[model samples]
Target: MQACGLDFGTSNTAAALPDGTVLPIAPDTAEPRLFRSVLFFPEDERTTYAGAPAITRYLEDNAGRFIQSVKSFLHSRSFRATQVHGRTWTIEELVAVLLRRVREAAGAQTGAPPEAVILGRPAVFSPEPEADALAEQRLRKAAELAGFTHIQFLIEPIAAALAYEAQLSREELVLVADFGAGTTDLTLMRLGPSRRGRPDRKADVVGSTGVRIGGDRFDAELMRHKLLPRFGAGTTYRVRGLSDKRLPVPQHVMAKLLSWHEMSFIREKSTQELLQLMLESSDKPETAEALYDLVMENLGYRLFRTIEATKVQLSREEEATLDFEEARISLHERITRAEFESFCQPLLTELEQCTQGLLERCAGAGEIDAVFLTGGSSQIPAVRKLYVDRFGEARVRTADAFTSVAEGLGRACVSLVSPDLINS
Candidate 1:
């Protein structure tokens, strides 16, 4: 049996075969072939759903725990486990659930389950070597639990390069930028028809670099600038210790509130108590009340969804309205493209710096023959401009933003076993 290719992304996921066939792991999402990296477990806890079904189920029911961005915590030593429906679920077990579902979905279509797979990963799981190794180890364990006997690792940006190489007839030095939800990874490599099927092409890889920042960080920035103020993140209140002094919410609390997974912790009595304190002491108690109500209603998931929708809309339109109405609170805000870009400027700079780091390993920035952009975040105007500024508009290209890595991983899987092992 041919090895399968798995792209377990932070925001989306996909599975494919060496033959370039992308498995329809998720049939109900906006994009059927690419599944959302989310899970929903009802109060019973025995039954669970993933991808679009998970989101839909969570919306229809409220007593369950819905989790998103599971991939982000893999590198963090602090995020060892989380309470799901009152049961402690480890990071490995949670990831295993997603892996098993992807494999089973592929198995149903491919006659039998595959035992081997090529797993695509980011260039930097974390800057800390120990943390990076631990993240990979956890992923390997999860794959094992998912029933894969043989697993191989491939860098995500390089995988995108392989997918882009299929379109070229001649050799070219290509720079691939994978702007994923949790990380931005880039690779400078030589690829084309002439280089295809070369078993030992390690020499073709010129340089690679990556950074931890990605699309999700930009979303958080937008929330911090445009929406958090409405929820008392920027409002001032009196604390018992600081008798006459007024202070805004602690930076740490505000940080947690911006992240979907971390926001769930707000339901704890300690955090709720803090919010109540703010509500009682703040001059603008409405904002503090909004914050308290948001957490109690388990509405962080919905808020993130609203933020994501506004983000996607901003990619196409000059401005988008963020309208969120739930129990006891209604919010309607209009954010212009300039404001969004301004909010995301820091992250966009970090992304550009990541690309520059990769290019420096080559002779110069102009040494790259072409720039191939992939991932949903690449479509952002500010992100694309940063690349264009360095490589020029004529040198930039794009592939299927979400599936390029999976497609290329499929190609890599095929090459791993083909009879032609040596390049002429």
Candidate 2:
């Protein structure tokens, strides 16, 4: 009768038990215990599979079997994927596989099956009004299919704040900046003492803002601009591809890019599609597999890691160097922190614009109580500095920067079902 909380994100999916420990579900499932979010199918036609083994099989036999970031697909009316035999599958089916994996993981984690579950939903789904309802219905159905008798949708930002509020005092306005794999959401909340005392908590939303960007998009940017250009896919080889000739390079690059999938770069359609297009072209015998391999290594995969590393190194160090020794591309000159800031400036600006819009909405209403910072991207000094600059260090705080929401949802699920076990 344990409750469950799932942070079904675009890049990574995580689940937590009532005891408040969170673990990642392995996508291509390696060891039974290690957690990953990716799910792979043996073939496009085969029912999509889940776990580390599935991922490995897909990488070797059918690289296209992956159905990544289901959370990003929420709200879409249809999800179309090709089976190994070229059969088409619906979005619901894809979701079903993902949900099923969640259930399986949960069942294995705890002896008792989950009676009720809490799932996190994005702030903005489809731009069309009708699409929003479709997204919600799809999610509900997927949850039911996954075996939860009861399911609840919680806003990610709010959930993150609630998780942090557990140990925090309920006296002030707080800001919850949730930078996940796909989107960045800023929620302003005020926590009040629980009326019921079963360790209950109340939260009021002061202002909420969302940006259609996050850590994943940044990886794509790096790959597209910095890494790919070197090998000349869109540039030198307009009809580029992956070939045996390009093996070492593409393999290395793809490995690096795949390594950073946690960044959620695949959500950006233009970039994702472009990368997909490149992959598709490589499928053709006409394109030199070597070229494809080279591009894949030089630009397709390796680029994002370099960019990610640059971003991270720039946070504390004044400069960082990225060298693709295999591909023979190197940014030997010091990449100054200033340069890194400039590179990320646009993303920061977009986030700022979103924040400004939220502020305008709350201008006359009330001030944001506290600024809660969480997520891998939130750890960036550039991002951190921005928040601190706006709301001083005292008002700006980062609690559980990585796993707050998932853990909070776990606790919330337990509380919703069995209030008496509050402290447990």
Model 2, range 142-240, lDDT digits (tens) per residue? Answer: 788777777887777877877776776455666788887778987777764552123334335676667777877665555544444344333221234
Flag regions of model 2 displaced more than 4 Å: 23-34, 43-64, 195-203, 233-291, 294-317, 323-337, 365-367, 414-424
Top lDDT: which candidate number? 1
Give the 10-residue window scoring lowest on summed lDDT in candidate 2. 244-253
How much is the lDDT of residue 319 in candidate 1? 96
The CA lDDT at 402 in model 1 is 92
Question: How high a TM-score does candidate 2 get?
Answer: 0.74
Per-candidate local distance difference test: 0.84, 0.62
Q: What would the TM-score be for candidate 1 when compared with the true structure?
A: 0.95
Question: Given candidate 1, what's the lDDT at residue 180?
Answer: 89
- lDDT string for model 1 (100-147, tens) is 888888888787777788899888999999999989999999999989
List candidate 1 segments past 4 Å from native: 240-246, 364-366, 417-424
